[model samples]
Every structure is written in structure tokens, then in C-alpha cells.
Target: QLGIVTATRDDGFVVRTLNPGGSPLYSVSELPLKLARKCLDVFGTASYDEESSIHSLNTGYDDEVSSIYGAREFCLLRTTSGKVLYCGKPSALGLKQGGNAGSRWQELIVAKAPKIAQVAAGHEGLHAVLVGDDGSVYFTGTARRGEDGD
Candidate 1:
């Protein structure tokens, strides 16, 4: 399978996944402007260094997203406002159960790790790495091959 994430001019995001033409099917999800504001508002205002890629929400910049990474089963969005969002298989996110059947844009709550600066998702694996504003690093997903930093 393959995935794509695009940022619209209206400060919203769209995600699409294409599965091989066999058993599974293709899917698409969108994060409209209204919901985007709600997500950003959850963290109040944004703050970052002048030289940093991070930026405040709704600053009218071309792209408020700092970076986007996709793994074997999911995708991670790191915004310029220092927030992290995800769309894809919830199990890849370590959730035992309870998630949408398909992918959807949802906030990734990294307890005690505020203001994510960067994120790395394994394209061929289920692991993910997050770098915080305070230089703290966090990992999630399977422990396969000790990629979880055990």
C-alpha cells in the first residue's frame, strides 16, 4: 500500500491511501479547516524559534506542516506549530483496540512530550520516533528487532 498527504491553501490537510488491486481497497480522508482549528486550539497558541521550521497556527504561510512521514501502516504529520497528528492503522499507534476501520486525521497525544520538533516513521516497519521541543525523544509501535530502543 501507499499513502499521500497534502496541505491545502486553506490550512487543511488531505490524506489518501492506495492499496494493491486485490483484497483491500483504496481510501481517502480530509481534515477540513474547522477541525484543523480545533486541533490547533487544543494546544492554545504556538511558539518556536525564528530559525525553526515550526510556526503558529493560521499564519497564512504556504505550508504550516513541518514534515510528514509514512510507515508501513500509518502516517505522521508534524506541524509547524509543534503538533503531531496521525492517520492510518491505529494498531500501528499502539492502541490495543477502538479506532476507525479506516484512517482518519487524529491528534497523537505524546504524554509529557510537548511540542514535537520532528517525527520519523518507519516505511517498512511499525516503529516511529518523535523529537520534542525540550530535546526529549519518544518511540511507539512494535518492539520488533529492538527498534523501540529497548
Candidate 2:
């Protein structure tokens, strides 16, 4: 089954479960942007500049207003303005404890590559693949099964 996730103009999102096997996090038929934001802890707008480095309107991470993708356990959002956001299990992304205690959105940072052209999430949200505007490809998350081609 395919997961459904859409981003609204107000920086909010709509998530739906395609089947009963869908995760409980998005089991709800529809959740308002405000509520979704509150539950996912998705706040702030982040921007990246080649010269100025990375900056966030509120948090340390950011994403533009554009497309959003829902995976089994996480969501990958890519904006037309060249930013990427990931929200889901912090451990799935290999984030250290204490800093990301709860599920929240974080920017996908690729060294020297400030702009992102596309983003993709792997099954169960265990891995992420990103394409940078500079033609650079980035991969994050776990690879215990050689899913990352390591």
C-alpha cells in the first residue's frame, strides 16, 4: 500500500493511511494542519545559503513550501525553494538521544550542497535518498541489510 501525505500552503500537512497496516501515527483519517503541526512538532522555516551556510526561522532545520511524501514510519518533504524536511522516528535517522527526544522535523543537510532537487524515503522510513541541486546524491539512516549499498 502507498502512504499519502500532502503539504498545504500554510506549511501544514494532511496524512492518510492507505490500509489497515498503516502506522498508528497517521491512523487518523484526516488531521488539521494546526493539530498535525502540534503532534509532529513541525515548526519553523529553515533556509540554506551557499555563502551564509544554514539558518532556520525558528529551529535549526528547515524546508521550503512544496511537496511532501509519507513513508511507513516517517515523512519526507521537499520544497520548490530547495529545502528538505524529515519527520519521524529519530532513531530511524540515527539521531542521538537527548537532542531529539520526541518526533519532530529536521532538515536534511548535505555538505556544500545547499539546494535540494528531490527527496525519497525508503520502506519503513529506515533510509532516505536525496538529490541536491548541484547533482550530488545523499543517503541517510540505517543500512543493516545493505539497503544503502554499503
Residue runs of model 2 more than 4 Å from their true location after superposition: 1-64, 97-103
Give the TM-score comparing model 1 with the true structure, all chains together. 0.54
Residue 72's lDDT within candidate 1 is 62
Q: Model 1 residue 100 lDDT?
A: 44
Candidate 1 local distance difference test against the native: 0.64
Model 1: residue 150 alpha-carbon error in angstroms: 1.7
Clashing pairs for predicted structure model 2, backbone only:
none
Tens digit of lDDT per residue, candidate 1, span 32-142?
Answer: 432334322222221211223433334233436767676666667788788877666778779666654233456788887789988887655588889898999998777
Report residue 56 deviation for candidate 2 (angstroms): 21
When summed lDDT is taken over every stretch of 10 residues in candidate 2, the lowest stretch is: 42-51
- The candidate that wins on lDDT is 1
Model 2, position 116, has a per-residue lDDT of 84
Q: Give one digit per residue, the lDDT tens place, for model 2 in 1-150.
A: 445888878767777655656555435366555433321233433222112333332333443356676654456677667877766555656656433322355775556886888877776656888888778888777876887777
